[model samples]
Target: MNDDVTCISCPLGCRIHVEKKGDRITVVGHMCKKGEEYAIQEVKDPRRVLTTTVKIEGGRQCLLPVRSEKQIPKDLVKKCVIELSKIGIKAPIKCGDLVYKNILETGANIIATRDVESVEKK
Candidate 1:
């Protein structure tokens, strides 16, 4: 069987044809250097930047924008987001604060990308 795909390296998406025959592979259709490399790497392993919000304690909203420092497995993004949604961080959270560490053991922990001041009750 052959799995032909495309490389979205730049504005010009190059159509790539990846033929895999039980560990043997062949790639074609590359416009640039990155296109070919991207196609091959994607076929072996695909990744995407993880961006989502976790719960917050003293913020007006229950969540804040947080992202993994680096791109992780695309499949894990959804699972990470769902897990973050259930978390609640305390107030006075500074940017770069560790909201949750060792999340999913992806070596990428959920952090506070924005600063939140603790609301003082009147």
Candidate 2:
């Protein structure tokens, strides 16, 4: 099968052409080494860094922004989101605090993107 994938490794967004035959794959049309590598991996196994918010209790905001520390397998993205949805954190949460460790055995921790201070009762 032949496919075209836009490389997102850098701002260039090179349109990479990929050809797959049985067990072999070839990628072309990339202007940089990183783009070439990205295209090749994208064809083999695509990955993405998951970013979303989880509920936060007793915080200034109702949700705490969280992100995966590393790019996760594309197939595991949904599962990761679902797991995150089922959990909530208590403030005071600091930026980079561990939200979930080794999430879904992906060896990536879900971390807070910003600080969440505890709300004071009047």
Candidate whose TM-score is highest: 2
Tell me how candidate 1 scores on lDDT.
0.77
* Residue 19, candidate 2: C-alpha displacement in angstroms: 3.7
What TM-scores do the predictions have?
Answer: 0.69, 0.86
Model 1 scores worst on lDDT over the 10 consecutive residues at 113-122
Deviation from native of the Cα of residue 58 in model 2, angstroms: 1.3
Candidate 2: where is the Cα deviation over 4 Å?
20-25
Per-residue alpha-carbon lDDT of candidate 2 for residues 81-103, written as tens digits (9 for 90 to 100): 99999998898899999999999
List the candidate 1 regions with Cα displacement exceeding 4 Å.
8-12, 19-27, 31-34, 120-122
TM-score of model 2 vs. true structure: 0.86
Q: Note the residue pairs that clash in candidate 1.
A: none
Best by lDDT: 2
lDDT of every predicted structure (CA atoms): 0.77, 0.92
